[model samples]
Target: SGALTRVKTRFYHSGVLSHCVRVLSLSPSRLRGIWASAATLAHLTSSCCVGAEPGSRSEAFHRLFLPSVVDVLLSLAGQLMSRSEAPPLLRTVMDAVGWLLSAHPHLTAQVLSSAHYEQIQMSDDVTRSETHHTTSCLPEDFLSQLNDESALLLLNDAVAQLALSSDAAVGGASIRLMSDSQRSFDVSAGLDSLLEKDWRGRGFEQEVDQLIAMPRPFRLSRRRRRSHS
Candidate 1:
């Protein structure tokens, strides 16, 4: 059943590969989503690229997915100039992509040929250390607050229900609360409590309702330094 195992491994690799791409797409912008996906990407990447049997499985990915990996990461590297600590997963994700790219004799020109190449080239490139001084900043807990998918989902549903409430009085109050809360997300305190109850084991919607009951409940947002900047 090794062949069958390899088939399943390839299938697994394909899905994880897609996840890394999505994270890259959202990076330096969707910092929280980047937060959510970083640990997941690292785990999945280690399993697929580093832990897998080295011969056929690796070769298949190198031939099929490596070029796409290079192109996508080229995009991510380009975007980091403006978003400080924007991607907590940048190192892990890049290691995975870097490992795959290393197997090649040389890097590919696929990015040069891709439509995003020009824009990527023109973007102000940034190093991680240089990212901190750029006037933009991410909340220190950006990764801790969004460490998992269920948490992100709950936050999204919480925002949606608050912003789009159907009850006239409650909707008005919720929107007003959201308007004030949108200035910053202090829900980091509530997140641990929110995530403590297993929405996966119980009802996710039920938990959303519970979260809706909390006063001053807020939407997840990137912090903008509007005061001095």
Candidate 2:
């Protein structure tokens, strides 16, 4: 009775809860008290359910929340893939992936690519910060997390699209927009230096040594400067 009431209430509201629940169902995490509610939502997203459309209110809400949800799902897929566990959850996760690719084809590539690189970059940062006693200039892992393969493809295609549309300036403009935040990404620049060194083919043994020898840049705040005098 209470469960059906919850489902009915969600039906009149948002679709995100339902989709997330579908994810949780396949998840090994054993979420408590919400499974029934989630199943109710998934029931609605099904083909037999009424009123699902690309530009409808429900779809808008899906777009708003779905990206973040997909990020979680991608992370789940990576974890499952890593562990070689192709359970029922994999099918559900694949369903979510298909939905993402179909509904947001333009964004799908970028999102996945960003997720992959973000994970690698974050693990690298954690190792660097803890082991080397360094401060990272990167924002919390969320900002650069958008650099995934799908997003990169979308970006590259977008560049092509811009050229096709005869708007080459858009690509340069995007780069300019990023340069607006240059100071904050200096650590990324430092990492770029290290990576490029390895690509030159003679620095295998000395890559880490060179990285270790590099100076960490210090940022001077106005308040710190004021305190000194």
Candidate 3:
């Protein structure tokens, strides 16, 4: 029965793998459940990639499936950013992103690219309100002003938040992800500029400098086993 269950599980995962990208188009109410399940599946598959030897079935599957999974994950992350009540979901997605980046360093550039950043536009009325003082600008007006440069800044901010999170797993994973991505893309200048003004205030200036200066290779840390009381 256990062997049968494992076979069935593989079939089920393969069945849904092809539809992972399409799942991103579902309505938010529907997507909330689907994204969670899909993300879990993706994370499991990522482990296969890490463990498989070169030129093996697992490696092939990982190479083919991971890019689409990353695309969907990035889309989900962008969607989550627009909602105030989606922090839990956002954190889950970010965790998945970090995991994938650690397992596949090549994915770093795609995940952190501005092309993946969601473009949010403001209405004409909001744009016209720019004449108002910066202090008086409404939140919508402020969001409307986020161009490509500002969008990159926001992306960096999200990464920094996760890198500095209270959760040790999240913080470690995010730092690894950011460092790998920076090394792969050589984005130090741009990323440094984005964090310059607030890095000192945020207390990660030295850490960021070190990460950019010398990126460590990706390694999956073993989970600590819990002892029974």
Candidate 1 residue lDDT tens string, 1-229: 5775576466555576556656655645465545435445543543354334435566666666556556665555455434565454444444444344333423323432344434432333334222111111223222243323423332333343333333333323323333322233445454434334422233244444545454543333333334324
The ten-residue window of minimal lDDT in model 1 covers 129-138
Candidate 1 residue pairs in backbone clash: none
As for TM-score, the candidate ahead, 2 or 3, is 3
Residue-by-residue lDDT tens digits, candidate 3, 186-213? 2334444544443434544556676545
Using lDDT as the measure, what is the rank order of every candidate, best first? 3, 1, 2
lDDT of 2 at 101: 46
Best candidate, lDDT: 3
> What TM-score would each prediction reach against the true structure?
0.34, 0.33, 0.45
Where model 1 places Cα greater than 4 Å from the true spot, the runs are 1-14, 26-36, 39-47, 50-60, 86-94, 106-229
User: Per-residue lDDT of 125-189 in model 2, one digit per residue for the tens?
Assistant: 22212211101112233224343343344333322322222222332332322322212222333
- Using TM-score as the measure, what is the rank order of every candidate, best first? 3, 1, 2
Task: Identify the candidate with maximal TM-score.
Answer: 3
The per-residue C-alpha lDDT of model 3 at residue 21 equals 53
